[model samples]
Structure formats: structure tokens, C-alpha cells
Target: MKGRAIAGIALILLGAYLFFMRDENISTGSVFAYFWPTLFVIPVGILLHWLYFGVFGRSAVGVLVPAGIVTTTGIVCQIATLTDGWSYLWPGFILAVAVGLFELYWFSGRNKALLIPINILAGASLIFFVAFSISNLLGKLALGQPFLAIVFILAGAFLLAARKSTP
Candidate 1:
């Protein structure tokens, strides 16, 4: 537990430093300049946890490390987005849903009830995201724009509910 706490604190400090550092103004665009390599820590943390679990069979620390890393990454991203004027919400939300679905598929037991709700929520969120993107792109369509979003949301909900009710 102490090790996990230390790792968590380290991740937070590293993220804070990365986000708060002074930006160097330059015209030449470099790949490293556009992307922060430190973000890879999240996946590296997940991999470390997986390896530990595989070797030791099972341990609470194994879970804590990965969860801590992901949570820290999310916090950093959220803070950076809000403070730095970066649009992180959409991508963050999508990544979170994808991760949740992957976890459900990989780790969950065969329980139809739990799976159905998760699928429905995932489907709805995906459809809403798509609708939002489309609406933004079709700004000139100027005819019942909000209605289109509502239609998409309703369609997604109906399809998910129907699938759930079906065999």
C-alpha cells in the first residue's frame, strides 16, 4: 500500500510539472513539441500491473498501481484541459468508455444483465458523440439541428433497449 501511495504521488508530481512548465515559443514544429512523451506513463503503469499480476497470480498492489496511474492521467488531463484551454473532454470520455468496455469483455463474468446495461450505455454515448461531431461539421444545415441530435439519441436508446430485450 505504501509503495502504491508513493507511486501515485510521484505520478501526480510528474504530471503537475509537465503541465505547469513554461512553454518555449518556436515556429519549427517538431513531433516531440506537439506530443508529451510523459503521457506514456499511463500505459506503462498498466503494463507493469499486468506483469505483476501474471507473475504473482494476484495481489491488491497489482490492481492499485494500474488504477492509480489511470486516475492520475485523467486528473492531469482534466486539469490541463481546463487550465490550458485544451479540448480534452470528448476524447477523454471516449477513451474511458473504450477502456470500460474492454475491461468488461476481458474480466467480467458471464452475466447478461450487467453486460446489457453497459452495452446500452456505451452505444448511447458513442452515438451521441457521433451526432455531436456531425452537427459541428454540418453547421450550415440550419434546419432543426437540435432535432437531429435528439433523433440520434432516441434511436440509440431504442436500438440498445431492443437488443437487450431480444434473445
Candidate 2:
């Protein structure tokens, strides 16, 4: 029964692919671009989860490492694709590895040793993401004397004026 189901699914997928490709106006690239997350990443993540939970049980928590990786990659790519933010968002790839390591640390008996690399990788990924994204967000905040002067003046004025007034 399982083999039959698998064969049926494959047949359906192949038929769908051929049916879609039959259209001359539709380029395969456009048709398949969004298919990767569904066809590969999602299935791979689910399979990893199934292995850990359904098949091997808690003893195989290590499978979550790859599951985390694939899931993160899919999320990052989906966000990038939707928002057209491929530029600074590339730091997510580094963050993805960190996430996988963190999952391994969390699930695999909470090994204290893994904390070091997990913290380092996650910290570095965040730092890079912040640094890279700031350039796009504030344009370096127009780092000039005028900007600093305004900020300082505002802070000083606000502090002095907002202080409690004696009756």
C-alpha cells in the first residue's frame, strides 16, 4: 500500500510537470522557481523530523540539525524572494548554520560544550546582519557633525527640561 501510494504520487507529479511544461508561454524557470521550497526544502525538513520523531525517537535528536538547516534556508529564501531583499539578507545563510547548531545543542541532551560555537555563530551572524542592514536602513545615519550636534542638543535639552520642577 505504501509503495502504491508513493508510485501514485510520483506519477501525479510527473504528469503535472509535463502538463505545465506543455504550455509554450511558460518558461520552466518561472514555473519551477517557487517549486524548490515545496519539492525539496519542505520535504527534506519533514523527513528529518519524521526520522527523529516517528522513526528513531528521542535518541536520534541529531536529525533535527539538518531539519533546522533546511527549514531556516527555506524561510530565508522565501522572505528574500517575497521582499526582493537578496542583498543584506544573505547574512541569513550564516544564521541558518547557527540555528542548526543551536537545535542540535537543544535537542541532543543539552550538551554544554555546544554552547560555545552556537553562541559564537549566532552572535556573528546577528552582528553581520545588523551591520549590513544598517547601511540600507539609515544610510550610516548621515554621520556628520551636524547630526551629532542635533542629537546631543536634543538629548541635553530634553533631560534638562523634563527634570522635576520644584513647587
Candidate 3:
């Protein structure tokens, strides 16, 4: 019953959107514009991986995870587009990357190098992204100065200003 209700609601909304927003200018290609990201998940992803595998074979198995992850990030970007949710959903891409790293680590015989970065990225995304999107952190960050950028600039400047200590 609940599922039917949700489906009904979706149908109604789609109907209203068609009635109010539809135009003769709308073509199949234009309709598919919103879903362009799916292309990356399919033809681009499959074709590139196929080509890579053809050239490198299992020796390049590690490429699979990151390629799949590019698709995942594209998927996340697609979702964010529908409602302009990038402000909150950007972390989701980071989380997706961490997930891809875990896949690599798992499938590539558990490389110790992947474990540290995976844990760090997953932890940072959970802590920072969740806090920014769900809690008071969003308000503060939005309202506050661009301190993060400033800090980055300052760090770069400091590096440039420093004298070489190597003797």
C-alpha cells in the first residue's frame, strides 16, 4: 500500500511536470540530457576498461576499481544535479572513492598501502561531510569566512618564502 502510494505520488508529480514544463522543443535527446552521466557508467566505462584489459590483461586489474569509482562519482553527480544537492552531496563522491579503495584493497590481495588512506578518507568523509550536511557545521561554514582557502594560500606562500636548509 505504501509503495503504491509512493508510486502514485511520483506519477502525479511527473504528470504535473509534463503539463507545466513540457514543450514541443523537448526531444528524446534533450530528455536524456539529465542522464548523460549514465553514459560514463556504460559505454565509456566498459569501452575503456575493455581496451585497457585488452592491452594489459590481469596485470592491470587494479584499474578496474578506479574506473568503476569514476562511474560511482558520476552517479553521485547525477543525483546531485536533480536538486542542486552538490553542496551536501559532494562528500558522497569522497565516500564513493573510499569505497573504491576498499574494493581495490580487497581484490588486490589486501595491500597495506591502501588500508591507511581508505580508513582516513572514509573517516574524514563521515566526520566532515556528515557534520557539514546534517549539523550546525553547514551554517557556520557558510556564514564564516573562507578560512580554508586562506590557510591553503598561506601554506603555499610559506613554502615559497622558506629558505632551503639542505647544506
Candidate 4:
């Protein structure tokens, strides 16, 4: 427990540093700057959570919880980026969520079937998120108006809620 706590704190501090200190040449301004650091912290958090469960809890759920948190965080950050016109870090965020869902399914014991629908939704969400991000980045498509972001958020929320409601 102590180790997990320490790692969590370290990850948070690292995220803070990245958010506050990283330099970007993208010219998107402060909003993009603010999000760049999260690109680093989200992955570190997932790794630390994996280590924590592998060493301490010895339970798959332990890893899943932290990984899920990391995924959710990425979703949140990407939403902010899209809505606020912040530099689109959507690719990183999508990758984080993908990894998180993979870890969740991979670590889940025999109840894997229970996560199927949730995984499907998460997968779809990832696809849309990535597509939207890519389109926006390439300047080939406009950012999804208000409704689209809400849809993604709500879908992510439903997946999370469903996971929580399950065993």
C-alpha cells in the first residue's frame, strides 16, 4: 500500500511538472501547452498501477481500477483539448484508453465475457475519438460540434458506469 501511494504521488508530481514545464513548438498557445504534460503522466500512472497490482494486491481488479482511471483521465483531457481548442493530444489520449482497456481485459480473470460489451463500446469510442482527432489535426474536418463531444463523454461515462455496476 505504501509503495502504491508513493508511486501515485510521484506520478501526480511528474504530471504537474510536465503540465507546467514542457515546451512545445506547436504554436497552439497555453491550452496546448497545459495538455502536453498529461501525455507523459497518463502512461506513467498506468505503468505504476500495473506494478502495484502485480506486486502488492496480486489481484487483477487492482490494476484495472487504476488503468481505468488513467483512461478516463485521457478522455477528459482530450475533451478539453477539443472543446477549448487546445492542441489536440487526442492520439495520446486514445492510446492511453486503448492500453487501459487492454490491461483491464487482459488482467481480468475468467469473467472476461462480462466485459465484452463494455470493451466494444470503449473500442468504438476510441475509433471515433481517434478519427475526430486525426481529422481535426489534418485540418480536413471541423471539430465535432458540441453534440459530438458530449456523445463521447456520455459514452465513456456509460462504459465506466457499466464496469462499476458489474461484479
Candidate 5:
């Protein structure tokens, strides 16, 4: 891409970001301010790439990386903004990685090797998020026998999901 085109695109995106931020009343000085604009740029980038490649007759699975990362970052930022800290939102990154891997596996001709790690990341993210939520809500209750049983059940469910997703 030419420098002028890139600059124009950047300016347009910046304008849109500023407009939305103002419209939504989201603080520009918030802790997540730095990452918020990415939610806009990343999706636009993905769509532009797809239009240039996919609609033009070619497409690649690599597009999913940015798509997943941006999505995960947006989710994490929103959650963190609400929670007032990073806290339990870190699992979002794992889920994003799993999303990327799953997209690759699905779009890149079902490469079997990607399935294992995708499942692992997805399962671990789910399990971690659940544990974090339970622990925060139940505290001592979360550490008792019932908690373990719930974890076991969730783990089994994760395994089953993995099995189902696999070819």
C-alpha cells in the first residue's frame, strides 16, 4: 500500500474512534484507553485484508490471528474496565489463541496437528475462567468438595467438547 493511502486510512479510523468514544461517553483517560482504539483498527484491517484477498479470489487462514487477538483484547479491556483491574480477564488471551488456532485448523484444510493445542487452550481458558469466577463468588465454599466436583465435571465437559470438535 502507498503511504498516502495508509495515512488516509489511519486518519479515517482515528476519526471514527474519536467519534465513537465521545458518543459512548467512554473516558479517553481510562486505564484501557491505550488499547481501545485497537478494537476499531483491527477489525478494519481484517476486513480490508479479506476484501483484498478473499473477495478477490484468494484467502488465507493467517487472517484469524489478528481477528482473534483484537477480539480478545477488546473483550479483556471491556471486562477489565468494568472490574477496575486486569483480574480474571487474562484468560481471554488464551481463548483468543484457541480461536486463532481453531480458525487455522478449519480454514487451512483441517490440519490435524492444530486440533490438540486448540482444544487445550480453549479448555484451559474455560476452566480457568470458571475457577476464577467460582473462587471469587464463593470464597471458602469454592474450596470445598463440591467445588472439586464441579471442576471435575467442567473438565469432563471440556474433554467432551474437544472430542466432538476433532475429526
Candidate 6:
């Protein structure tokens, strides 16, 4: 995680990309040309938040939530840009918020202050997923909808099992 180590890894990745460009049909350079800002913005934001949290001993959910949001948004943007599916990526924002809220809820020792946002964001992500599916943004079988359904089912089952076993 040191600066020199990260720089070395980045250089190695770049070297690999350059070496693979001849065989690949896509242009990695072009992609980087367009998304360079995102490459820096996302990691730097997350790193800052993580450093801040580390200083606090990772006990602060507030920092963790924002960090997760920043990281997720960056990754979603990169994927959408690469795939040329900007419109289809709209749901990712909702998902990022939901993830951040969930992280806050789960890591903040289940603080009551984080509950409202967690529920709200999670609901919003579901709404967006359904909307995307009905609109066929990514096709009839939008991946998020099924994944969300499975997640919901699994979570519900787990909660039920936990409750039944609790006495």
C-alpha cells in the first residue's frame, strides 16, 4: 500500500497493457485518454476517505459510507464508458448510494442515525432496478433485477432462519 509499491504496480499494469495491445482489438490508450480523470478521481477520493477512517481506527461509519460511494461511482463510470452504455449505467448511482448506506449501517455498530438513509437508498436502488428492467435499458433480462431479487430472497431467508433460532 506504499506509494512506491502502488506506483510500481501501476507501471506493471501499463506495461502489460502495452504488450497486449497488439493482440487485442480494443485500444486501451484511447480508453485511458477519455477516462484518465476518473482513474485518478476515484482512487484518490477513496484513499483519502480510507486514510481518514484509518486515523479514526475504522470506527467511523460516516467516512466509510462516503468512501464506498466514491469507489463504486468511479468503477461504474469506468465500466459504462468502456462498454459505451452510459444510459444503462444510471442505476449504478442508486446502487452506489445503497451500498454506502449499507456499509454505514453494518459498520457503524447499527447506529440508528444510519438506518433511515440505508433503507431509503436500498429502496431507491430497487426502484431503479425495476424501472431499468421495465424500460429494458439493458434488455429484457437486466442483470441487476435478477441479482437484486436473489439478494433479497437470500437476505430474507437468512433473517428468518436467524429469528427462528434465536428462541
- After superposition on all CA atoms, what RMSD does each candidate show versus the true structure? 11.8, 7.6, 11.4, 14.9, 10.9, 9.8
Model 4 is weakest, by summed lDDT over 10 consecutive residues, at 85-94
On TM-score, the leading prediction is: 2
- What TM-score does structure 4 among the candidates reach? 0.39
Pairs of residues clashing in candidate 2: none
lDDT of 4 at 38: 55
TM-score of every candidate? 0.40, 0.63, 0.55, 0.39, 0.54, 0.57
Model 3: per-residue Cα lDDT over 1-167, one tens digit each: 97998789557645644554456365667545544665445456555466546887667767767766676677676666554567777887778788778867875778899999889988988887776675445355684346656878999999999999997
Which segments of candidate 4 are over 4 A away from where they belong?
1-40, 43-54, 71-101, 130-167
Tell me the lDDT of candidate 4.
0.60
Residue 47 of model 4, lDDT score: 75
Best by lDDT: 2
What lDDT tens digits, residue by residue, belong to model 5 across residues 1-167? 67998899768755655654564554656424644535554565467447535674235557666666566666666556544546566788789788767766766678899989989998999999888766666654546667778989999999888845566
**TM-score of structure candidate 1:** 0.40
lDDT of candidate 3 at residue 79, scale 0 to 100: 68
Query: Which regions of candidate 5 deviate over 4 angstroms?
Result: 1-59, 139-167
User: Which parts of model 3 have CA positions greater than 4 angstroms off?
Assistant: 1-26, 41-43, 46-57, 135-167
The C-alpha lDDT values of all candidates are 0.53, 0.76, 0.68, 0.60, 0.66, 0.69
Q: Which residue pairs does candidate 5 place in steric collision? A: none
**Model 1 CA RMSD to the hidden true structure, in angstroms:** 11.8
lDDT of 5 at 90: 74
Better of 3 and 4 by lDDT: 3
Clashes of each: 0, 0, 0, 0, 0, 0
Task: Report the lDDT of model 2 for residue 11.
Answer: 79
What is candidate 4's lDDT per residue for 1-167, written digit by digit as tens?
98998799668745654564567333456544555535564666667675757665545465665666575665566446534644454444445554556666666664567467556656766677777666676564454466567888999998888845566
